[model samples]
Target: MTAPHDVPDLTGSGEYLVPDVLQPGLTLVLVGTAPSGISARARAYYANPENKFWRTLHAVGLTPRQLVPQEYATLPQYGLGLTDVAKRHSGVDAALPGEAWRPDELRRKVEHYRPRIVAFTSKRGASETLGVPTGKLPYGPQPQPLDWPAETELWVLPSTSPLGHNHFRLEPWQALGDRVRELRGAAEAGNPSPETPVL
Candidate 1:
């Protein structure tokens, strides 16, 4: 969703964050907690130099080469998209106010786009949207929950933030790439609804 009408458009004024990269038939959509302060200023997702999101995506073969955050607009060319549960906010999770989160809006976007997969870039984001405790959510493909559309799969990936240093691992991301590849193959074979293996 674009910023509310009342809120000034940051992109056009060179002061707002980059608009979300989303559309139908996307192979994957990466949802983060919110844009970091650096990202907001730079108008890019995962813009912080310390954030490993872009590197991880390249390492996992999701991108042809490592992309700088500034190149986020090119994500859809690779069948990928970017968004967040908190659209109008930009900061660390702890600093965000209660109104920052809009899970219902996220659900609406996901359902409307019907991407093949919706992967949360952090457990905190997944938990907030799924209404489950972070401790209960595992890293990788989630079971087909009632709240999500059956055509769209859900995944919880480790956060690439510097703050998540203790929990950072590239294995789960590589696994996500594999799943996307599998899904793409299935779709090419006229089996777009192949059941995703729960992880």
Candidate 2:
């Protein structure tokens, strides 16, 4: 197997990061607040082996195949895109210490990309980045979708953080996966897909 890469420091860096392996007009875009320990080392957001991302997508039918860590960037081929709320890496999400992600940049991404869905990997990302209240924000299109938003669906599911509710990733994953299914349908129909996975 190939080795993972290390995360670059967030301090004093200037870059307008877009979703990893995002295809123009992709169906869904997965977001995180920033890189995690595993992702930082792997140089791919959500590259952690323990992360249920691919398995959940497979279960929900977004991906017709399985993927190892290095293949994460290839997710867009299966109609998925990866990105972070904050483009920097701070080893752990908790290490973020505060609102490390910028809402303006995220809004800009949404407006520019106009992805069908925007899903946050964790509630922290949604709360810290998106204007959502924390803790289990639900499993469908947000009740109050943004007007200045990218016309993409927004959602805030449970945190995929290893430090989060360690035992219940699958349940939330399944629910989120179901939502993804709906978004994919919209994408296939050329309608506004209403689901975006956020970190």
Candidate 3:
């Protein structure tokens, strides 16, 4: 697979199932385990109709209006971004190869972009990225990993995938959205954003 000419190979591996929609100064970056088959085929994040990601973003006030998958590239204007752990693969979590979950590369991206908050859309992605067992990870804010930028925060949200319906919850996502809005409000007010909690 060849990297899209328009999207720089941020990681330099030269390919992505779905090009990352990311840039510096984003308020939030939604990290997923990988694109679903439908999304990879569409070359857009959360393209699957059954996925609740797009709706959830609007429901939580992260996006002013509901956006279809095709509008993913426009998220940065709303202070949001998107990427996945398994960039070279696309499928359900179980089918992904071990090598595809590149936590180090994700860490590198986070260190460089320094988004105010990084939220994993599923426990599995959070676990793989943080090296913590999924059973130990709670929803919502997470402890900042060592060596991460001081101004950056981390969060874990329930997966919006229909396959994860049994465990899906909106409260955590709502909390994150609320925090994102708070930060934006503070920045717009020319006030120092609230301190990131130690937890």
Candidate 4:
């Protein structure tokens, strides 16, 4: 299926495969490499039925309940947000064009929104953003990149995409959920949470 031409990119870069669901002051923001063909056609993040993204959010306690991809716009109410490194592309990672991955754009968004935590749904996205080789990127929290805001934390999670079955592991996702809850709790109590250690 082709990406819908009617959707406009607010950033003026071009048409977005799936409009980003984001806002300032979110507790967490999940970043992906790009929308899959199915997601682009649906104009929703992780719209494929086989994709575990939505279910994992609830299973890991990031959301109160499992959310359909169509309900993505409501994530801010739950202190969650979403975006992709390749806004104009829609396909599997291997098929994406080199120019489509704009790590700087993602950095600007994260710096502006100031979410408490930013987790990459796949190592490829994180690797591109951090300029590290995928083989060197480990799961869970990572060291702060140079010039990254100290208040915001970075994490790497296994891809929820069906194609990522070989690399998928529930443990890292669970750890991320637990850490998000901790940060939320600390914020609710008006206490400063300690920095999350790299896992």
**Tens-digit per-residue lDDT, 1-199, candidate 4:** 1123322353333577787777668989999999999988988889999999999999999899999999998999999989999998889999898999988777777766688899999999998889999999899999888868788999999999999988899999999998988988888899988679656
Clashing pairs in 3: none
The top-ranked prediction according to lDDT is 3
Instruction: Estimate the lDDT of model 3.
Output: 0.88
| Model 4 error, position 75 (Å) | 0.6
Q: Candidate 4, residue 119: CA error in Å?
A: 0.4
Give every collision pair in model 4: none
How high is the lDDT of residue 175 in model 4? 93
Each candidate's lDDT (Cα)?
0.85, 0.63, 0.88, 0.86
Worst lDDT run of 10 residues, candidate 4, spans 1-10
Error of 2 at 32 (Å): 1.1
List ranges where model 3 is wrong by over 4 Å: 1-8, 11-13, 197-199
**Ten-residue region with minimum lDDT total, candidate 1:** 7-16
Off by over 4 Å in 1: 1-16
- The digit string of per-residue lDDT tens for model 2 on 89-155 reads 4556667755466766566556666676787777767776656667546644465455555356676
Poorest stretch of ten by lDDT in candidate 2? 1-10
